[model samples]
Target: MTTTATAAPGAHLPEHLDFLWRSPEPEKAYDVVIVGGGGHGLATAHYLARNHGITNVAVLEKGWLAGGNMARNTTLIRSNYLWDESAGIYEHALKLWEGLEEDLGYPILFSQRGVLNLAHTEQDVRDSVRRVEANKLNGIDAEWLGPDEVAKVCPIVNVSSDIRYPVQGATYQPRAGIAKHDYVAWGFARRADEAGIDLIQHCEVTGFHVGGRDGDSVTTVRTTRGDIACGTLALCAAGHSSTLLDQLGIAAPLQSHPLQALVSELLEPVHPTIVMSNAVHVYVSQAHKGELVMGAGVDSYVGYGQRGAFHVIERQMAAAVELFPVFARAHLLRSWAGVVDVTPDASPIVGRTPYDNVFLNCGWGTGGFKATPGLGWAFADTVAHGRPHPLIAPFGLDRFVTGALVDEHGAAAVAH
Candidate 1:
């Protein structure tokens, strides 16, 4: 493990991050095997070593580390959901995000610039206010701000009544903000690597060998690199989770969709706070580098493609211009997409699978990046004890059949 100097507060990030984690060859077997090297998997591995003292672990990534959704997300972090179950997990993650920099001994560039989920219609106002009350009951900081107050938070937004979807109000979370996605991934990777965990790249898991008496447990994971035996297997593959679950003959109701996001050319910082409008179907925030980081709902169609349809981008920009009139002249820099695994209720599925010693952590959709630290903490405990953590117990696979789903479609504010 190498020790890199932490940047001063509000200082510019290094042009190039020094090699923080070692690239080690995958061993034939390990105590725990995580199938994705994204933020979630890396965080889980870090907590597995830090909390449980479990160091013999391997994180298998088909591509480069954090090159997947970890790099493609819009980088918004908030926990103002409308349900108790949703609030529990997300708020926990927000608390973890508040202290992540010092905990990782790395500069994550986490900014608590606050977030405002705008309401454009009467119904939007009703829903936003209701969610604000729910967040308050959950002990989360939330406030319902009128259009004028919304303007005070973000002056550039087009809040006049003349617009098609005029701002009625918004739900504001003062603690919510964004972080540097790449830095968050690298921070977790460095810590996990320091704990003697093997972070293996270009190692794709192709199949699974279930060899218990009743064929109820996975004994070995067959990867592109080679087969590796494991005592416990955890799937944190995000959009590609179904591909690996298919090898184990598990039928999970997961749909993979292309979630697109784009950034504008670097300019003077005009946006002061993060603004999101589910009615307009777009969200925008100013990054540390002065780029306007923006994104919208996922593509309607299901596919594994990393790039999204042009129509989605066109609609996203149209929505952005309508919400923020000043953004009309902003030059489009570049765009990219990530495959997100969505569930029927727009909530994640975490906990034990039908197979013994096999854990599942997917279906996070667009909210995965925000839930990195909290999910990692809970999932690591789940894997260590071979049981569902209380925080994630409500999101088990049985919810679909038992009619106990944590439906977040309407409350999620965005098509997660």
Candidate 2:
């Protein structure tokens, strides 16, 4: 693998880019075939070679690498949740983010500047405090901060009593922060490429040919490139998982919704730590380039469009100005939307389907970016052993059937 100088924080992309991965043609067959070339798929391919010694792999993307939801996330990373299962997987991902740069031999710009999930009402305070305690019990760093402390951490926030949603308190995780999303994806892609895993782009999987004694295994993956036989298949496609599942004649309990986010023009550093207000429906973090990256809840309707309703963006900007009064003057630079596959429980589905040799890792909703590394590790293990990894056993498709959902709607710090 080639080593390059770490880009300075918030620096613009270099005029010339390093060749990260190869653009290879699809092979006739492979030991394992993964659909999706976003962070999860790339990370899974990297670990499949580094951990399990499985190199005969192919990751197929409908578009360019990381061009889907991976490119359109707010880039907030945290693991403080109300439930044990939620805490486990997310905290694991936080640990991986801490050392991802060193492990990948690449610069990911992972900044652990801390995160504050704000509480506005009495009930919000109670929930935030309970989540903090739950995080401590699980050996994760967490704390409860009052309005004054919240101001000390982020002075620009409007913590006064006159606001519609006055600040009561917040759950603070000192280890939680943000990273350069594209850099993280490139780091994983480069390593997987170095390991000889095929990162094929512009190759959409149209359908699958299933054949086995019980007719429950995928024999070939029909893609735009051509049909390729596979020993096993894994679906890591985020928003389009349901569409792909439909091709296999499998009913998935997943709904796709548009999640919108926007950034302000570059300016001097004004925001420090990450601040998220679920009650008001706004989350804000200043990027390395000095832009205020902000996002809110998903659109109510189900749609595959990569853009959101104007009313949603208007509401998000209104919430931002109310919380951070200073942002009222900040000019809107650009905005975008990413389709997310949400489940009823607001948790990811990461396990087996009816097909014996096919696996799934979807239904992440708005929290997919944070779970990339952790999910990649567990999903790769699950695909290698042909069983649900213990870390992801509770997230199988049978959960909906058996009433074993890992519900995280309230604790997720965002509306699902």
Candidate 3:
């Protein structure tokens, strides 16, 4: 049976009471309205209040909090990119990950176990060398390790020449690792709520009410529950970014695709660090509970369905066994997929749209999870000051026409 209770306004609930017990109903107007409640959106709201004192905010989610891509990734973190633009933003996120737990006052289980991107062929070696050099130039910590060094770092990897894709060498980032994905979302959500930011779930945005000169401003948002007037509207929707933008008669350069990941039954710890192989199309790291968290490339076609084909899973399993032959006997626990928004250049878009008051932070492709804190920090700065932050200005939508894309396809395509 459903139970209801009432308390005096502004009264704090007991510690044992659920956080949802005191959640306020959505207000009719807000200074800022965030259209998605994933990690990025929640983080944006938190920073908006914590950094800028913009507490009159609303975060609208179509489903339960953190139920989207925030909960559906393999949880790998890294900042070793080839370009300066990509390196700067992602490296910013890596730094934030260092102090995030203390900042949020929540346990996120961020482990700096290191990440190894294995190279197999001659081209892979060349790419690794170039990327490590560029990363160093951008003040990112990166190193190219030979096969012998790779084996020392990760003792179980099959560096033998007999494998389908031999591990010729690898690029290692000692700071790159994995964190608890769900905890990341919940931590931000809890902190945002504590700062009086409304987190409205099960509220789907139906259309946008655009007004002002040439309809360049979004005055209100029409959602399933009701209309909400807002001074500024920020779109942080991941795969559904294009759908929501289309309601405003704006088109985003994004395509939605399914990215698959799986976990194996719990076992004793054997994998010491995160391992990824682009040639074999697989990447893996052992979870805190000893489950082997694994993933590969995205599906070839566009899909809104949160599932991939069996053949894709089959190929990923083949690749996993090819790299770590000891994983051949591990039983599968669960497998699932999340819809990711892809762009032509394989980088994120995080700036103002053509609209005067509407901003977008989509096109993260398959790498959005690692970029959550950085995206939120820059996006909140953009929405607060009506200008893109210097760190993310290079990712503006104007780049598509100006032909100044910060293409990171070589690093972002696989093993995000």
Candidate 4:
């Protein structure tokens, strides 16, 4: 249960209880209403109220704060996609991360150890070189590193110089790194709550009370218990976006898929820089506490299900053990899975939907967690002005309608 401390009227300004311990009464209609109390939703609300003049806002979360994929991500931060638009925008996210702690006045524990994407075959090498050139041309710091260099960064990798699937090289982005996940969410939440945004937890959206036949407006959102009147709605529901949109007759071009991540027992910090390989279909990194965090491909099919067959985990372990001999002896500690909503082009679909006031911020594939802050900023701009930000123009939902997809599927496999 969520605990609440009573405050004098107008003490916790926006909607009284800061984080809204109870839905309380709708009190008054808000300027903006955000769905899914995850990081993106919370950060957008924070930016909207603090950065813009839109203070009257209500954030509706189906469950507790940031308990969805925002909490389940592997925490690998990077902007080294194969395309410039993808890299440039995500790089902007990297810059934002550099100042997150100060902006939130909270320690985020960001680590800039860099990311190492490995190439195991000739094709892998070609793709790696092509990507490195693409990234460098885009002003992102990316370079090709051979096996000898890969050893310098990831010495623990059990790679043979001349063996089959030999490590041809790697793409290193010194600008990419990892940050504390929950801290990001909490940092955004604390600031938004302090700034007078109503954060409603456990307020599942039962349906929508949309106005205007064009579906370009929202009158109010019917909740499990109450109806919230708001000028606009932003959906940051991720894996649940399509389902939520379906409730309002808005068809989202996204489908949900399950992705699993596992962590090993605490060991001496054996892994340093993040390591990813498409050939192996595995990627891993070690946390400050020494737990080895790892992930593989997502389930092929679509479902809200978070559980997958044990064989998927088994497949991932084989590759991990082969790459790093040390992992062969480490005891497995825990494994968990999350559902992800993917768009056709493997990029996030940001900005306006058919519904005038309802905006979408989903489809990061495996890269949403770290993109939270920047997405928050851009998304808030769109909602406040009812216009798309130039930086995120390529990812508009209408891109699909116009055949202007910026496909980054090749680099996105290990992107986040």
Candidate 5:
């Protein structure tokens, strides 16, 4: 909660430090109130201050900063989605990620080594080719790699046909890679704070006072801290999106499930680019600190617990060893899970609600971390202009009712 002021050149000040202060207490009213202080909400607040000149904004969090799903994700980022709508939004995020460090003046350990989605069956190859073609058509970089090319790109992967899900080919995106998830969240939080955005942690929203000329709009948000009035309220509560919306008598088409991930004991780099296999149901990537970060599908049932069943991790490890036999010997360092709010079509819901000046950005599912900056940029525009950005307009809640969902389950493989 404190930043040390760095010493000026040859001046008397703390070196490599900045001024420190406690987060301000919430005011009676803010121009805007954002629920959840995760990367998306923090980014949205930053953009509202930087782009829209909305400095009187407050971001409320139920826990300490970035203590929710933002801290629980495996930081894999990519934008090689199959659909144009999905591609557009994620690609915008990718571009923002490419320059995030410089923009935030914070090192997020951004690395664009590459990412490869392996193909195990003939149908997998066909789908990979189709997706690659679509990605190229949309101006997103993607290529289909044969077994030999896939092996060359990631030598540690077992490409032999002897395995259960042998590598037949793969879809490769050179721009895809991982970043420091915590750093990204903190960087945005720090910048948002500098922009005069109130980051009120431990301030859980309890309810809202709905009143307007039409008698259906949120005039004030009742929180653990106290009720605060706002002209507009944006919800970015991720897994708890439904819980928060229910307080307003609004129901979102979101199903919450636990998605787990684990990191192996640190070792010398053996894995190269990020490797994934929908057929085997595991994805592996090495973190900046040398731990093998791995993840797979979510649990079948719905749950609010932030931890998942042990068998799910066991199965994922079994699949990981099947693909990379070397990983069988690696000891698990730690494991955790994040509750994700998934939509039926595997796409995000970003748009206005039934009530005036009440916006919702949820149902990002497993791929929310990768879309942080883009969501912030677009959602900020949405809240500022009172309409969604064109990139996210198609992902509105109406898509579910109108049956225009953009299904990307295949592209968002391994629960991100």
Candidate 6:
């Protein structure tokens, strides 16, 4: 197989030359203006148009659509979380994914093959147990698996009695699998376009014409190309949401982290499910095209840079070879990186902003790909009704200020 330096899963597109340099000439007022045309933004437009009859919307992308973290992900989808509220919401997302193809009239390649979080130590086993218990409370199918059971699920994994980062056990959920990331975005984009939503590409949001916190809430937004008078605004701009928030004088409780992902040439189908290992700091799975997708920890510092040094790549290789010995001979195909918008506690903030017409759907840290539908669905609900969804209310920006974060460090350490 081969690898390529493709654009990030989701990114902002520039506006057309006719729009203006950095601000459009207040063309038209949209019922809702979604910043960042990633999966979240596209899904939001689809739901608003498809479900709520709010078709007078505009999806503003600073770059090509879905050019950010949405396309950089390794496509691991699972709802096995450690917080009842979070687990509940993610489970809701899982349900939406189950019917995504029929809902969008397009294929998402949603597979229920399952995801395995390998436990390399006693604490890993304990954490798996805790996640299982927590997820069970929210009606998730998270099962604790011992070494033998792990082998039963994926015999290719060296879950034997002796090994580096020996397999003590694992956390397995049957309902998690992979999907084509770009396809998901295109599917939603097609539906949203069909519903009469203007996909204004190449539009950079430089600032907003904030008319105070009272009525006329955020009347217009000044973009790199032109100004758009949007009735409501939803920020789904991963890695760039904070900048957009700052433009509106909104201080978000989020940190930006750059994550790297690599893919190999198409090989024989050896991996069916996603496998995550914290002890090795690497999670890998084979894509439908048969390329082994590999990802590991992030850099020590946080920045918007999307390149890495040999040091990081070397460490990733060591972990991959240790886990799958055959990979030792595999040639290096391609490597790429993305700037992920992370929260202090590593959980996503997906609900409302202080401004009445502004909503937030970012801070996904390491797992935004799986929550694309959930974030869009909940965020759209917030924008449409001018109130936060019960599931997303707890994840408001106030959580960090109020010290009410749902700290799921266990999952964040590896899987996220």
Residue 288's lDDT within candidate 5 is 90
* Candidate 4 overall lDDT versus native: 0.80
- Estimate the overall C-alpha local distance difference test score of candidate 3: 0.86
Native-to-model Cα distance after best TM-score fit, residue 225 in candidate 6, in Å: 2.5
Candidate 1, superposed: residue stretches over 4 Å from native? 1-18
Each prediction's Cα RMSD?
Answer: 5.6, 5.4, 5.6, 5.6, 6.2, 5.2
Worst 10 residues of 5 by lDDT: 1-10
Please report the TM-score between candidate 6 and the true structure.
0.92
Model 3 error, position 94 (Å): 0.7
What TM-score against the true fold does each predicted structure earn? Answer: 0.95, 0.95, 0.94, 0.92, 0.94, 0.92
Candidate 5 whole-model C-alpha lDDT, 0 to 1: 0.86
Q: Give lDDT: candidate 4, residue 18.
A: 43
Q: lDDT per residue, candidate 5, 187-299, as tens digits?
A: 88888888888988778788889899888689999987998999999999988888887778887788888899999999998888899889888889999989999998778
Which segments of model 5 are wrong by more than 4 Å?
1-21, 410-415
Per residue, candidate 4 scores C-alpha lDDT tens digits across 155-230 of: 9986697554678889898877888787788788888877878787767778888788765588888886588888
Give the backbone clash total of model 5.
Answer: 8
Clashing pairs in 5: 3-18, 4-17, 4-18, 4-19, 5-17, 5-18, 5-19, 6-17
Clashing pairs for predicted structure model 3, backbone only: none
Cα lDDT tens digits for candidate 2, 123-152: 888888888888899999999999999999
Give the Cα RMSD of candidate 6: 5.2
Each prediction's whole-model lDDT (CA): 0.89, 0.87, 0.86, 0.80, 0.86, 0.79
Q: Name the runs in model 3 displaced over 4 angstroms.
A: 1-17, 20-22, 410-415
Q: Evaluate model 1: give its TM-score.
A: 0.95
For 1-416, candidate 6 gives per-residue lDDT tens digits of 11112344454444442221122232568878988888989988988876688988888877777777777778888888887667867788888999998998888888888988888777777777988887777788888888888888987787656776888888899998889998898888888887878877766777888785464478997877777888888888888777777777778876776788888887998876778888888888888888899888777787777776678878888888887887777777898888887777778888777787788888887788888787778877778898888878888888888888877664533436
Query: Residue 348 of candidate 4: its Cα lDDT?
Result: 85
